[model samples]
Target: MADVARIAGVSSQTVSRVSNGFPGVNEETRQRVLSAMKELRYRPNSAARALKRGEFRTIGVITFTLSTTGNVRTLEAIATSAAQEGYAVTLLPVAVPTQDEVRGAFSRLGELAIDAAIVIMEVHLLDEARLSLPPHVKVVVADSDAGDRYTVVDTDQAGGTHDAVNHLLGLGHATVWHLAGPEESYAAQRRTGAWRAALEEAGQVPPPLVRGDWSAESGYHAGLLLAERPDCTAIFAANDQMALGLLRALNERGRKVPEDVSVVGFDDIAESSSFQPPLTTVHQDFAEVGRRCVEGVLHHVRENGLEHGTALVPTKLVVRASTAPPPRKVIPCS
Candidate 1:
């Protein structure tokens, strides 16, 4: 602080005011102080700053896989928002929330000195595990099914699936076959329910559903069965990866997309548009999901108490070349 002030020809108090973001510093003084800071390459100690302000200068975000597109996007959004708010983020990765892992994570978080935490566990059955966090630290659970006891932020998986299937039905398809993710996933369950409901409401029998573990391989296997079925015209895949696999399976079997079978996929992954024929899929705004989660956590942090609320982000259907009207009738075997 003394060195920077000497370099900038300013008082130490002026340097302090500039660094602490006090508004009274003149523009010229602020610029000079910043220039001095850059020349000195002096990095402020966050821990020391926190100690003086009674803050950690950081928040924790805990999630399973950082590699998944959805998870990555959500984390990025959270980090971006936190940075904008002048806070650093500490990322904690846990594979699956077991009782021990949940307990351990919270314990480690306390040692790290974070102001609050956000958990990105998206399964409905993890309600029992959500209670393990320390109550002193504000906690926000994303995609939670823990009732109103915990704050939650989640994309409208069911609503997106409903819109996708409804679009297919409106295109005059007989029925939309579903390729779902692992049965245990909350998103998969919601999507499956919505698909079934849409079919039921439309007076069409819902086609048999094939399960995938959110993997392209599983989707490829499911696609093989779909290709052989003459009644399979429109297919709704749980996510874009599976949809890509389905596309490959259909291509290999000499079935033309939209011409022979229409496909609708979820997540609207980045590569969806680059497929041989662009994919039509559902888009979940993951950044919005992250923002909501941060808001929930911040709310609790300020109040020092859990806020019981469930926020569902909206989803939209992106139409492309992957869907069209079904054939007039199944082509007879030669």
Candidate 2:
């Protein structure tokens, strides 16, 4: 600092202001200090600055898996939002959703320099691993049902499902069939419940539930069975990938979409619009969810206290070519 100040013909205070990017330093002086810094190859000590400020300017993110579209997109949004806030993101992927694995992740985060953490996983394990989190680190949860225990930012899963079912029903389908994701997923569970409720609310009986592992192959198998059912008019898959497979099965089984069977899917993934027939689906704002998670984390950090509640990012129902009223039940003249 002193050498740079002397070379730049500026006071140490001026150099400090320039290095820290504080205002009031004219362009010429700032350029001179920068040039001196370049000549000396001087870089500010981030660790020392962090210690002095009592903040690492980093947020740690703990997630179970990145294979799912939602997780990957949400993670990307978090990194982008954090960068905009002048904070860096460090990710830790848990190999499993077990309590022990979650605890291990938190323990590892505790040893790092992150100022806070945002957890992206089911809250059941998080409830058990709550004790393992570092005392000084604030936390915000994403895509989980921990609102009563911790701050949570998530998509309106139930609301989105209701929109999907209602959209199908409003189009004149008697009832909507659901192909759900794994039972263990909070999101899948919420959507399933909402589907059933939406049907019952509309005075329609809910049909048997179909289960999938969030895979297109599972959707294909489910579609084969559904294709055989003469009464199955409208179907809702849990995600876009599954919907793609469902479309293929329906086509191969001689069921034309919107002509024989209409289909709706959740998660308006990028490829959904290009499906054999563009899919009508629910659009979850993963970017908004991620942005809220970071905002909640920083709020806790600034106040030095945890705020427990759920913040839901709204979902939209995107109508496309895949949905239409059920095929007319033609009857022969008696």
Candidate 3:
């Protein structure tokens, strides 16, 4: 502090004010202080500042896995929003999804230098972690039904799924076939439930669900099974990666999308637009979800209580050439 003040030809108090973003300092003084800080490669000690302020200006992000699109995108949005809010993000990765692993992470909570935490994982893992954290620790969750337990920021899973299913049915398909992710997945559960509900509401019997492990390979295998079913015309895949594999399977089986069958997927990933026939999908506002997670945590940290419940971010159905009116006659799907 002394060296920076000396270099900038200002008092230490002036440097402090500039660093803290106090408004009293003139613009020129602020620039000089910042320039001096840059020249000296001076970085503020967040831990010390947090201690002095009685709040760590850091957020702990505990994630089970980053392999999935939703996880990765949500994490990215969290980091971006945290950075914009002048907070550091600390990653706490749980290699496995076991209760013990989650509990272990919770045990380390006291040692982490963070004011609040945002957890992204399935409901079961979240339950274990929730129990292990300090009773007063502020938390925000990104997936699953945390109910009244914690502040939650999630996409409109049910609404998006309903739109996808209804979109297919509205296009004249008698019923929509569903490609669901793993049963334990919260997003998958919501999507699958909505798909079935939409079908039942329309007086159409929902087709049997084809389960996938969220891997494109699993989607490919599920696709092959669907391809063999003559009644499967319109497919709603849980994600874009799975839809990609489904596309391949359909192609190999001589099924022309929109001609013989139509497909819609979730998570309008970048590659969905480039798929062979392009893909229609539900676009989850991951950026908004992430922003809300940070807001929920910061709100709790400031207010010192969990007074909020689920904050929903809306999803949209992106229509493209992949979806169309079903063929008039019974056509061989495979």
Using Cα atoms with residue i matched to residue i, what is each candidate's TM-score against the true structure? 0.90, 0.95, 0.91
Question: How would you order the candidates by TM-score, starting with the best?
Answer: 2, 3, 1
Find the 10 residues in a row with the least total lDDT in model 3: 125-134
On residues 28-137, what C-alpha lDDT tens digit does candidate 2 reach at each position? 99999999999999998889889989899999999988888899999999999999999999999998677788777888887888889999974346446342444555
Cα-lDDT of candidate 1: 0.85
- 117-170 per-residue lDDT for model 1 (tens digits): 988775533435344556566888776675477777889888899899999999
Q: For every model in order, what is the number of clashing pairs?
A: 0, 0, 0
Please provide the root mean square deviation of candidate 3 (C-alpha atoms, Å): 2.7
Question: RMSD of candidate 2 to the true fold?
Answer: 2.7
Q: Considering every candidate listed, which one attains the maximal TM-score?
A: 2
Ranking by lDDT: 2, 3, 1
Residues 183-278 of candidate 3 have per-residue lDDT tens digits of 878899888998999999999888787999889999899989888877788999999989989999998998889798999999999888999898
TM-score of 3: 0.91
Residue 268 displacement (Å), model 2:
0.4
Query: How well does candidate 1 match the true structure in TM-score terms?
Result: 0.90
Q: Which candidate would rank higher by TM-score, 1 or 2? A: 2
